[model samples]
Target: MSLDKGGKNMGRMKISVAAVFMCTFIISAVPASAGTSGRSVETTLQSDLAGSLNPEGLLLTVGGYRRWISGMNEEYGIPSSYVQSGAMLGVSPAYSHVSAHVEWKPVILAQVRLQYTLFRYFGDFGALLSFPSKDSPFGKDEVDAREGQEEKDWGQRYLLQPTLTAKAGPIIIRNQSDAAYFTYNGAGPYFLEWEYDTLVKDGGWVVSNRTFLLWEAWKGPGKAALLAGTVYEITRSFSADLTRRRIGAVAVWTPAEGDGLFQKPRIYSQVGVNLEDRNRDGEVYFIIGAGFDHDL
Candidate 1:
């Protein structure tokens, strides 16, 4: 491994350590609700740590990025210069076997996603639906427009994304497609609303394969430590181009106890390297995020 590879590995380790510290410090500093036994609370907390499998809780997380890029692939369809400093706000509320998730990148992009677990075999298999911002910053026909230029009059877009997910043991896999329709700005006849366009027009559908394995590294009742091995992704879009491949690790810490803001909190840190693409060299992006989990 080169120096960059070594540094990236260290970054992943740091995130794991930080998660452990966060779980310990928060649980110790916050008080639990009165009258509920510790064992009872821990049992309830266990469900929240099961990721989307449990499927019943409120999750809120906010974080800022040194580099913020829109679209599925880093800068595939968007201008590289437009990727700038930004903050992301995400909320996911799960009820029964269904969950609704929303993520906003302010003016950059926004997406609303719905996930439903149709059944559970060895593990859980589900369907996911997403509506994302599809309008180009500039008019679609303006091939010469510069990046970040706000369009005074342009067509708006509505996109629907559907995905299939399979989770078994520690492994998870997802397959998805993005379908979109466009309507001219402020147009009334609304005839355009009836027709749709595919962003990946050249190809029938954009296909991506994502896989990851998560394991419990350590646990003590309400508090637990986790480590993950991820293929992160190797995206093959409709354009017949490979976006970028990532292979990395993630560390997480979840305390089954509540802080004032949330009854259960999860802290995660991930470090991954983008494999060198024809257009850009490989780089490492380290992300650390914390979120509260509350049962409704």
Candidate 2:
């Protein structure tokens, strides 16, 4: 296969089983406590959506994440949610410092995302067109915004993530970091990820640019669920041209009703680590984050 063609399908197949795994998380939030009932209608919408089918509403991932941006510039945020390890080498582990809660209404899915990478704040608001499981592009030819070159590295990252979902699985296409260099210049690096899953619990496999096989336990009760993944991570220092390698793991915790998007009191938190990569080198990371899910 050609280099360009090969890079598109690098890992995570067409729909990155991992992405599909997180995409379907359903949150069953507890009913709002006494008081705070007569607030605004907007508040009510946020609240109803909170305990709805996607606990991802108002996601705050905190722990730690590191990225070698350019040759000499490196960013490591210990308590931020939107951690950007800068697509290190091949695989870069990230702790969600800031995440958005996804709300799906029959046909359209809306999202509100917030992220803090180090000191930089990134927020997102958008919508996605949903598809049936029989038409998704699980493994196809597309560039990886993170692993490959065309991906927008730095600066504003805004785009609609058009996904294909089918009985075979799903595929996602988008940019990498919100870097202006690639985004403004139209360098692209648009990547594709794919995965195949089933209604059966723990019956799916995920593929992405940096990681190999990943699986999930589909059945759950709490808004909080456990997701695990294995990866070969790559770290590149933009200024130094220094490179680092490590074996990594990804854990995502999504809860709801804390910040109460509907104006109810709801809190959110997330923590994760790439254990082996840092090893005893102290290159490890920890991300701690929290936030509110609001709507108008």
What is the alpha-carbon lDDT of model 2 when measured against the actual structure? 0.23
lDDT of each: 0.31, 0.23
Question: Each model's number of backbone clashes?
Answer: 1, 79
Which numbered prediction scores highest in TM-score against the true structure? 1
Q: lDDT (0-100) at residue 72 of candidate 1?
A: 29
Q: For candidate 2, give the lDDT of residue 117.
A: 21
Best by lDDT: 1
Task: Tell me model 1's lDDT, rounded to 2 decimals.
Answer: 0.31
Residue by residue across 1-296, what tens digits does model 2's lDDT show? 12243432322211211232232221211112223222112221221111111111122222222321211101211111121221101111111112222222121122222232211111111101111232222111211222332222222222122222111111112111111010111221221110111110111111112322233323233233333444343433222122334454443334433443332222322223333221123234322222223333
Q: Per-residue lDDT for 1-296 in model 1, tens only? A: 12142222221111111122223222221223333232211111111221110111122333322323332212212211222232223222211121222222223122222221111111111001111222321111221122222122333333344434333443433333434333333322211111111122211233433444555455444443354444355544333233446565666666665555476667765567767433223756455566554433
Q: Model 1 misses residue 121 by how many Å? A: 40
Clashing pairs in 1: 258-263
**Model 2, poorest ten-residue lDDT window?**
192-201
